[model samples]
Target: MAETRSTTAPRVVRREPTLTGELLAEFAGTAILILFGVGVVAQVVAGQNGDDDSIHWAWGLGVTFGVYVAGRTSGAHLNPAVTVALAVFKGFAWRKVLPYSVAQLLGAFVAALIVRWVYADAIATVDPRTTFDSQGIFSTLPGAGVSIGTAFLDQVVGTALLVFLIFAVTELRATPPAANLAPFIIGLIVVAIGFAWGSNAGYAINPARDLGPRLASFLTGYSTAMREPGGQFYFWVPIVAPLIGGVLGGGLYRVLVERHLPDQTDAEQPTGRIPAEDD
Candidate 1:
């Protein structure tokens, strides 16, 4: 033969996403969430352009989109309470919990910083002193006549409802929603919680959602960010109560619903849905 020529295309090998990739997904997802959430709050409080209902819907939509962004890569444990709940009940890796939580916290912090920068003029005009009133634009605070104990209980109940419904809707054996629909349903759960319990402490059912912005506010001259207007240390309630509520909710779901579901063979198990457990 005078000449032989081959024109085969090269094979492209795809690798699975690593933990680092997952962390990045979580970080980005949470940043998207906080950007919408904190930005909306800033608009309402600082810019005075919206109302309470507006805040609830925006936050819900934020959660929905956040989950959609990171669900495939990281199982989208955007809330540390969710991460902790999965580890406690659903066999998520314990070693990854702290990393995931840190990533989420950092994402919220960065997003809050961006919101602060964007709304700096409005905030400064409304409350030049950066007092507790201005701080509410970034993080949650107790409502009028709400005591610390009541706020803690509100968080516990709100987060319990969140985790309980999350477990219910994600359980493989249960009639779970389609993977595409699960995130929207979860978002509705947050909205419902906000409508029912937000008045107590603005429904800070996720610790990172509160603490990250609180810290950002503190650094940006809100001296009362870490405390209530009355000067009582109130930062711990959102962090601690939601965690307890997550575990309790997951446990309750397991005992009451999941345990009673009919078992499925390995071959019958579904794939490509939003996984109830982390990878």
Candidate 2:
């Protein structure tokens, strides 16, 4: 039998944005976060420009802008703690976790470099005695009296509060804020965490936010960047503790609030947070 070709032309397949694009969004979102967040710290510590209030607002607004920048694309989970929590409890894909985390870390690292560059002269002048101690401008530092265990606990509690409140704010079934206010409420949570727990450990509630900038400071000549003032190898505390706390927070929120909700706005899909409208 002879084969014959069909007259119909082949249909074109439109290529969607790849993981690379998502990763870029994550990177950019996280960069925006660190740019303002760490920049405010530099302003306060180096230039004596503002106090704790400035830091709190700056970091909160940083998160807000970051989410706005990448929410549609990557969901703007600028913090690894948040990302992991979503994966565990909010239906985020597990496969993308590492990529998102690495991208966030890179963004934060690069932003720290930019902040250091911008404030080099001011930092040098701020403390004529030492440059390394200025690493706190880019990363977190525990208070003078806080021990390692105390700082770790502080980070856990702070991050747990952060993730838990995030779940609450984003919940679709519950009374989510009116008028797409999740991002703003999320920002406020960060501000609240800073105001409440910042004195204990500088409130490094996000692993990427803390570790990425700290890595930059270490690479750039801060000998004690990874260690605290009292010979404490405190670098891992934020990274590990936030991950733990975030998972705990998410789980706790699901158990405490989500399971109890009767509205079930997203009953079919059952995601804890609001599912994006169908494309």
* TM-score of every model versus the real structure: 0.93, 0.88
lDDT of each: 0.89, 0.84
User: Worst ten-residue run, lDDT, model 2?
Assistant: 270-279
RMSD of every prediction: 2.5, 5.9
Instruction: Count backbone clashes in candidate 2.
Output: 0
For candidate 1, what is the lDDT? 0.89
Which runs of model 2 end up more than 4 angstroms from their true locations? 1-17, 128-132, 263-279
Q: Can you tell me which runs of candidate 1 are displaced by over 4 Å?
A: 1-14, 266-271, 274-276
Q: How does model 1 score by TM-score?
A: 0.93
> Per-residue lDDT of 191-210 in model 1, one digit per residue for the tens?
99989888989998999999
Give one digit per residue, the lDDT tens place, for model 2 in 1-279: 899999999999976557798899889999999999999999999988899999999999999888878776777889899889988887788888899999999999999999978888888897655454577897787898888898898889898999899888777666777535677877898999988889989998998899888988878768788888877788999999999999889889989988998754334433433522211
- Angstrom error of the Cα, residue 48, model 2: value is 1.0
TM-score of 2: 0.88
